[model samples]
Target: MSKLTQLFKKAQSNYDNYLKRDNVDGLEETIKAFEKISQSELNATLKKATLTELQNCNEVLFLIAKSYTAYAFAKQKELSYTDAVDSLTKANQCYQDITNYIAKIPPFSLPLDLGRQNTEAEFYKHKMKFEQAKMEQFFIKHKMTGAYDAEKAYEALQNIATAYSTFQRVLEKSYKYISYKIDFGINDELTNSIKDELSEARTLLAQAKNKKSKRRADETPTSKKNDNGNTQKKRRLRQRVIIEEESEQIESLSSINHSKEEEDTYEIPASEQEKRQATSESLPTAMELSQSQPVPLQGLDLLSTLAMSFFAPPQNVSSPLPRMSSTLENSITAQPQLENTNVFWNQNSTHIKDSQECNRLLNEWSLIYFNSLSTPVSEKDNQALTLERLGHALLLAAARLQKESQFFGQQKINPALRIAVQLLSRSAELSTKHFNPELTMKELSAQYAPLLKAFANPGRQLYNLEYLQHLRRQVYKESLLINTREASVTDIVTASFKALANTCFGKDYEIVRDTCFEALLSATYALSKNNHI
Candidate 1:
């Protein structure tokens, strides 16, 4: 081969080698070498070459841009924020040049490879914008409270919002081309990431606005005391101003939700809204109640109240009672009231044990993890980790139930088991829906299998296993049919209950039915407590 051809071939081999390495420092050194070559022999060769030669030069630029973008991502993963931002800026400029160069070539004359390069360039351009926005967000987060500048923070947030908007627009425009060329769903990832960033930016903007409003309100003049001081009048005026400020704060929060509602109205279809409403209605009222209340009601007290409401007969008799009948009625009522009051007092005297506190903490963390899954930017790895932790929580809860079963009978263990199953099944369904490997689903299922066996009858283990597999298959199929749209927690819980009802339980079928009903009630209560619905 000629010296010129040999040089090009060596450069291509080196580029391919650098692309495979994971070390950012090595990649940086390779980039420097390429730049030196590009400035000397490559520049001279490019100046004298034809259209075909210019296309080859553009290919070289494409490789360089890709390397720079990869290095930027590595730096980001390392949390070297400033260096990552600088790398991304340079990468973006390189991609922009590639985009402009390809646009100048006639459509009829443009090679297929050039079209692919152009799509890649557009992808990196938007990708870099997203990275830059993230860097700004990181900077804002690390700023010290004492040194924080409200104006600077607001400006950073605004820039991030703008970046998200522009990145979204670019992705939407180029998605089809990129999808065809890349043979993967770039559009979905870009859309979800940008949507999350935009939501965060808007939230920060609202907070900033609220802070500014509060400051202004605090600075407003209050009435001064006169020489013949009417202190009462001044106090009343101050109270009225405080009330007005509180009302304004409420109005601001309502306005934010109102705007979100309007946006949701356009995006959410009628069918989806109906599904959501049905799920919300089915969720337990206790969950909503708990969200409002400072402390959760004791499990025993809640169960007692539910039992009384469900089992108490109506008393419609209004006849005047004989002395003996009245005395008997008073004695019966007083006895249960006295017993219940004494039980409540006794229960109050005992402190919560370490095990119970640990259990409570586990449940709280599991709920938080579940809530985090709702965020658009949540990753598959994070989701898997959360699910694994939930599995551990389930095991801990099962152990507690097993201990309780020794004292309270198997029937008493039913409610806790049902909740654990619902949580496990939902996590499994999510793992599948998000395209997690079958191994992840299998590992989660394996973790919960022992608990499932502990709850199921010996003769019904096969049936329970079949039902679980079927539920997972159905969830996966439905997710695929719906393009992997997320199912609500209510829907997941309801489906799990339905599965439990349908599964064969041998001689314990009646117990299973009771368990399902209790689970439904408890789920509704939990949902209500959290105001999740």
Candidate 2:
């Protein structure tokens, strides 16, 4: 017999032994033995093993790859997600190459672990399963804090939905053609996970569309507000017109209303007129006035008086932040009056560079924004852009620190992440997009994603993950993890009652009643279990 046939037979024997132990699906030995055979030079010699033997080897590889994918789902093992995904990817790629290698081989009696022959439907099922796992991994890793923007999220979800449809077709075909045994639970799991990340991704996509539509609607064909080329001229022109109109109206109103004596009292002075003209010449071109010109002792008061004059400002009124539309600041929340946000922009990142240079290029912008966080989002004309940019800066900084752990030793974890949650939350209110990239390959290891999502789009969204408890499902798991203590069972019971008694049952509270109560009940039971009886 050829060396290839001998090796394939030996690997088949090992896989046979493993299956006898009641693992109908191939497991540890099946993977190792077939993997060695695949790496061998004999695998390239198609004539070494009979056509039937080659098909059997391919079936074994498919089963192994399927097991690896299930392992990645956290349905198996407590290890980091890196190991799981790598195994799945390697197995998936290997199976794909080998399948192509034997593509010319005709369908035959490829015996299965189920005492029946494998069919073409089996191949289709394996392909769909692998694709679904990959999409899930992608969605989890890139859902919030990474370079995975709304479009990526939307596409990944669509792919997941496609998998769901494929599985349904696979089951129906299997039944119709008497193919390999298909499990009903396959449909259940697909329906559950693919629900295409379900409403969350769709909601983000919808909100993104709305933001774009609103932006386009707000655009004026006459004015170039979105133009970065000549914002200074626009600002200067707007101020000049406002000042001139105010001066003219005041002079005309006084000309009709006042007598000669009264006219003396209201008469415009030459110095004042010159000052108004000069002020008209300069109304603090965007925020550049803060950096270039020294504010006089009462410049803020003077500027405020200049700004709030005469005409009620329209929705598209000019703002002090360069190239940022004032309409974008419609519902800005006040900046958190915290210590880090006071001046230097610490955990909060409230301060930034005092110039327009940061927006010139992506790399330079990233650098400047990363190094300096001296700007407040609330004060920006485009508060949404400011918030998203600052959040991205923090996310980038966190990712760097994570990468630098080898040389820098352990780093503080939550400060940047916590602040980023706040920023992204406000940004999502204005525009439902988090323009960041993957922090890590692992799905759950990227915890910042859930926190960011929960903050940004949180409003009574149901999270049905059985793995995480109430604290993590509906709230920040980080804070709950800290200072956890063993309280008496009675204490937990009493606390629950006290909470219920004190809480008001208004319409806003109604939205979260079930979510909060589930959390409370689960927390109480868990604490009771962890504590002394």
Candidate 3:
């Protein structure tokens, strides 16, 4: 006999011993034997083994034995009702092993009754019970080989018939339950009911199949209907169209819910908007509130504080130390605030002072903005464009703010000469930092180079050193990292010429900057030569 056949026969013997003694003595020994056998290697002949063969193999027998551990625990006399529950638990483990192996096959379809708790232990218990029921039913309905006792087989089949019937009915009931998703809110109870029904069905099926057939000896055919109204009636098979349609609907609903909740921000009502603003205005301004209990100020309020500190120092302060502390703090705070305020100063005096300071800064930043524009930047890579644009915008803002400052302070600074000088120096520095072809370390040597000297025009000077070179360098470094090509000599020359062409020497005199115009013409010629190569 094949190893699978031998394994089944051995299991049968062990089971018979258990029925006679109601103990695990023989079963344990059989299990050990099966475990050993499963570990033994078989040739390629086993590759052709069918599902039946695999079920009857030593491997399955070993699993069945392992599954009985829970039952063994339950069997102890000292154990309570909880201990007796071990039988189902052990059976569950075996069922899981069987299911896991079965699921690996391609295009596998688990039986409808097999939809138990989906846990390995529960799955194994259900699977083993079903398989055992199937095997018993098959044997009972069919006769065994030589040495089979017809009397015992018939007796066992009759004993298991009711159990098999009950299991089948339960299985059918569960099939109906899942067929229509009956949801009364308590999913757990519904699920448990289904599992219990399936388990019962499997047990009944196994018992019914265990009986040996005596049909050949008896000349007459037995009636299909049983005495207890539990007849083996034919069942109608269900079609897949309804289930497929329901599944599609569930999927569509899930997709719609996801799309609805995906936005980064949501809108607020106008009433809520008014309430939030009212709450904000109730808070004290930074100046009104003392340092120890400083009122809540937003991040950009620092720039406003700095500008106010510069214009209106508290008239009562005596010591130089406190004045220095307050000034430093105000400057630091004002840096962030400048970007927050698009419109600055309401009164004429404050506006004039702020505007004068801003204009001086604007002149210097203007020079930086024009110069950076002329520099060759990569048009190929997308990242390069973003950095270039960011640099361009920052410089433009710097110029606008500076212009506003100078316009505000024009009346106070008299012909704004002091602000004018400050503006001219920083504008030169910005030009050298961004537009100068050579990043020379020489101590202001050749500081009066055409581009730097061009910033000296009384009409176009910028005062804010803080606004001058820092942002230009930041943008330039970022551009370099993003660009594929390095800023070459020819690129520098072209950029310088472009900067000169765009700059205003004065409102009325363009001829004063003839050297720059000549340089542009030369750079154009140089570019033509490089293209031919």
Candidate 4:
């Protein structure tokens, strides 16, 4: 082999070695060393070189260009636009120099190869792409002043959208693309992540545009959350804002049957949910629901910020109860989105056990998370899953309201009571089809009976006589489903009276507390004709 081929062989070895580097520091060092082979670095030598030397310079530039591409791809993983821009710029410079000093290159034998696109046209295509990535990175670097940028956020999103659309095409075309994946494994996941972020950014930006005239911009919570070392609280709250699905849900409850009117009315007030199967454009916002009037689009700036957190890496949720030590989290006046819960929420006022405070903090997060949905939960959507998840948040709020509800001074009606019942009842409904564990069924039955008992009153508009009668029938059916297989007459009677709590007490449905006693007696009789109590 000629000396020229031997030098090229060594250059090829250096190229493969440099491309093998993964870390930022190692890649940087490789980039620096390989940069010596870049056009400008070789310009002085090239001007005085022989034909063989010029050919060698061309090969060296080719090797360096590929190394630069590898370095750029590695830096892109760090999500640092400055680094991406810097590395890709070096790469494009090398490729540009290769075409400038056009020559008949020797057979390609480099271990590290980008496969196709060896032509001048291909080089220019990739260089343009590198430029596109730089522009996109700039847009990301300047992402609208967090969610507070509000209306101003539209411009940043617009820039990101343009660049995102172009680069998406660039990534899919090159299967061997280094930037697509770190180790060149699956690229779809990362690509989809970019798509998802762009989609959410667009959605938020569109909403911002529509409300720009009416909605005032605010600052981001990123600083406030970091204040007073309340970063952990911020994380717990951030997780809730996601568009919740079954896999990501809390525990669920078994539900009973209800009338069509009840079904229409059965919604966790202020809980916003979007239909799982609905299209992006066609999906309705939860605010459109007559019952789910979440904080308006004006507060969506916060939603815009919170929405971005969903794209973040999976984080460990503080086990069970979560504490809110930060003033930003505890301030009710600051969070205008939630209903004033001074009656049920006591930890906010008085010093309490850490557990109680944590419960309240979780309550706050739940309200905020549901409110953040901004979109409508589809009627076709199975609300059972959402209600089950919500029930977990409402218990503390529910228990407090149920207690203070007996006293005259704090007779102030709290929405938590109704909302809690709505969640529990909806999740418990037998008609409400869900795949959640059947284990929580008995627990739901126990909780649902009392909540309905507390909520039942003659004059309340929501629980009118007609609805109570329907509910009484539902109770009778639920009891039959629960207690018919009794071993003894005493067991049957004991279970019957226990089931009576579920029936509305003030009125009679079938002459004797909805004839529940008679129905149980008849059921026990049918089980054994000779046994009568």
Candidate 5:
């Protein structure tokens, strides 16, 4: 069995033990086991599992939450208020997360009985219990001091009230669902009691607010005196210092607890640590490698270089002539030698000069093409001619880039090709708008049929197919714009099939074919349902 299967089995066994024991001991262990199974690997396994398997996983998670609640009750019975609060909080969060997952699954997909569990109601009830425990803990801690922090106490009370209200609201809606129609003995009675409690809690909260305001008002003069007098100011400063020190202590304790939890979750064995250290020591150092290796040019860098070379003006070359000959025989002999030297220099620089000229020409051509695209086309202009020119120019630039890419490697070609595809697609759109072909459906299909066939070249990359798909969509959309009835379902299906078929010869062919086939099937189904078959 796989590791996930083993983990699931372990979780199930622990859950069973927790259920049988009816105590917090087994429940704590079960929660820890479940937390381990909640790691990313297990999550990926669960996602890839079948629907039935996923349902079983969710069922286990739900039972775990129920066990947590039971554990909280057991802790409460032992008067372990802190432990009880912690368990209840975990239970509340688990229920909320499970409810969210259930919501994402289609309503019809869930088991009928699973919906009857009322996870949302459980979440709020546990949340209310947690708040109550927290308030009680606060009161217990302050019992010796005989001093109440109105803000903290009131906040706790407000949370309790909110949780109770939310729980009642969820329970009310639960009664309407068929799955929740079972006559639980105390559903209605408990809901009513909760409503009554919520009302009382709100009243107490309002009273607390009034009391706090009155106290503040009574202390205003004393607070003002403390702020003004030097002795009072010193006393206030001492209180501030004490508060900051207490806050620091609390923060440190929380951090220590967090670190302990992390250590418990991912404890590494001494043997594993030794192995990791050995592996690190065995690896070669970067400084030991040769430094003269040429760094391969990246796609972005290459494109930038191409852009700069195309736009930058050529640098002037200066050559100073040798001192003029003082004698006729010396001048004649020097002239012949200088001519030979100049011929040799030109021969050596021919490649560089040619490359520069190519860049200059390409720059000029691109500027002209973009300028024409930006310029408005007239009704009388030949749209086909304009499109051909733009398309050829883009293709030429792409070819030159591809040639340059060979000097680097294949890995650097894709980025430039993607940019070229975008330019070509944009040009296609401009062509369609300019032409605005007003033809019958049959005529439009015939016109685009050759173009589609020409574009369906095998051995093309995925990006190439993506561009073709974009072109196909634009063609159909433009056809619809010019003549509403000038495109047919057959045209669309044919184009889609051609594009998909082109992927059969590329890398990851099987995966791409399956995906494209599914997409095509979905599109065909949609078309048939609309009576466009």
Candidate 6:
């Protein structure tokens, strides 16, 4: 082989070795060494050169450098903008290095070789893109807020970004192309089947809830007690009907068998016979009836509840009779003593030994709870009637407690009676104040007014029936004129009688002795004698 061929072979081997380097530092160093050796060979060729020889050397060196640039980039440890720019810079330097060699040659009468310009253009294009990518990294990845000078720095970067047919063209080459596909593991048929099962389960759950709600509704004390009372009343009616049917059947049989004898010779004596006949006539049969069907005695269930509460000592109830020293017991007996007895209620009240005081306190507490109501009872508003009923129940319970708590033959005044009187008085006042004029307040007064009158009566000494009669008379009189479009003095007196009837338990003297009626009727009569009943 020629010496030139040997040197060329040596340079090729070294260039190949440089191409194998992947690390930036090693690749760059090897590239520099290869360039230096090639340049030395080109220089030696130029020094002795024939034109053909020089042209061959220049072409060979150019091809070698271009091949090395591409190879160095391929073996790059990391393919990023920084390394790309660095490689482009090295390639530009190699081209510039050849410029010096070309400058020494005679000027050619050729247009400027646009290849250098094109190469420079491509290098600048990539450089701008790299810088823009770095800026984009700052904006998109790092979430930078400040302004980016991408205009001055990477003008062609925007054009390159827009030309991308795919993410692979980007300087970073790290973008992902994301897409989605429906998972048909569950489809229309499966979905419909699940819906059917879910609907059926929901229906069953609703049925269960309804059944539970109905059971709870049935168990409410009001409905259950009303049903039980009605049932008992029905049973009594059935018994009464049976008795009347049997009696009528017996009378008919007797009358059919001995009609003439029953009329002519059935009497032992005139008076005795008449008496028996009269008794038979008076007796209610299947046909003959009386007004006001008797109300069947339905024993109060609440009384039973109260008895259970009284006799069965709850954990918190303190029995005053047993005289226990427990804190719970002290709490109960001390309720009347506490200025604010509202705090220690059911828990300590069970221990209450003094039945009278306990009853009184309970009634008082109930009345207080009732008096706390606001008006125009809406769904959201507290109900006045509920509180009033609670007070009534408490009073009824207190009555029982009063009797239960008394010692055998130890006649002590029932404090509950006083409390009952006070509560009734307050209830009457509230009823008068807020009660609709159309509704007869007499119903409430009928229950409580007699008790008041009995308390106020001078003759009874134990009761004051006179003052009660006076108060009730006023209530009735006022109620009568309250709503009357054309009420006169007469209306006031008539109402007073109705009030008297309810208050005095239908006693004849209730109507006669009412003070307001006496005054009202007297004035009416004085004005017109025909106005008297």
Index of the highest-TM-score prediction: 1
Name the top lDDT candidate. Answer: 1
Tell me the TM-score of model 2.
Answer: 0.30
Clashes of each: 17, 12, 54, 12, 0, 18
Query: Can you write out model 3's per-residue Cα lDDT over 1-533, one digit (the tens) per residue?
Result: 46434544345444433443454655555544444433224322244455434333324333344425422432333322222223333344343443444444332343221221122222223233333433333333333433444444433333233233333332333323321121111134434644564454345333323322223324232332323342343332122434555665676566556435422111111110000111121122111222222112211122123222222233343221100000101111111111112133233323333224333333333334334455653432222222222222222322333344433223222112222222232223233342211122112214323222222323323333222222222122111111112332223223322222232223211221232223333443454455441
| Weakest 10 consecutive residues of candidate 5 by summed lDDT | 323-332
Model 2 scores a C-alpha lDDT of: 0.34
List where candidate 3 sits over 4 angstroms from the true fold.
1-5, 37-48, 58-74, 77-93, 108-533
Point out where model 6 deviates above 4 Å: 1-7, 14-30, 35-53, 75-83, 96-533
Please identify model 4 stretches exceeding 4 Å from their true place.
1-25, 35-41, 44-59, 72-83, 103-124, 127-153, 167-533
Better of 5 and 6 by lDDT: 5
Tell me the lDDT of candidate 6. 0.31
Q: All candidates' lDDT scores?
A: 0.43, 0.34, 0.30, 0.36, 0.37, 0.31
Worst 10 residues of 6 by lDDT: 322-331
TM-score of each: 0.37, 0.30, 0.20, 0.28, 0.33, 0.19
lDDT of 1: 0.43
lDDT of 5: 0.37
Summarize candidate 5's per-residue lDDT along 317-373 as a digit string, tens digits: 222111000110110011111101112223332323322433344334433443445
Tell me the tens digit of each residue's lDDT in model 6 across 145-181. 2332322212122222222211112212211111000
Candidate 4 lDDT, tens digit per residue, 375-455? 744432334434444443443444454454343215422333333333444354322343211223435544454444443
Candidate no. 3 TM-score: 0.20
Residue 337, candidate 1: how far off, in angstroms?
A: 68
492 Cα displacement, candidate 5 (Å):
70
- At residue 364, candidate 3 shows an lDDT of 39
RMSD of 2: 33.0
- Backbone clashes (count) for model 1: 17
Given candidate 2, what's the lDDT at residue 320? 18
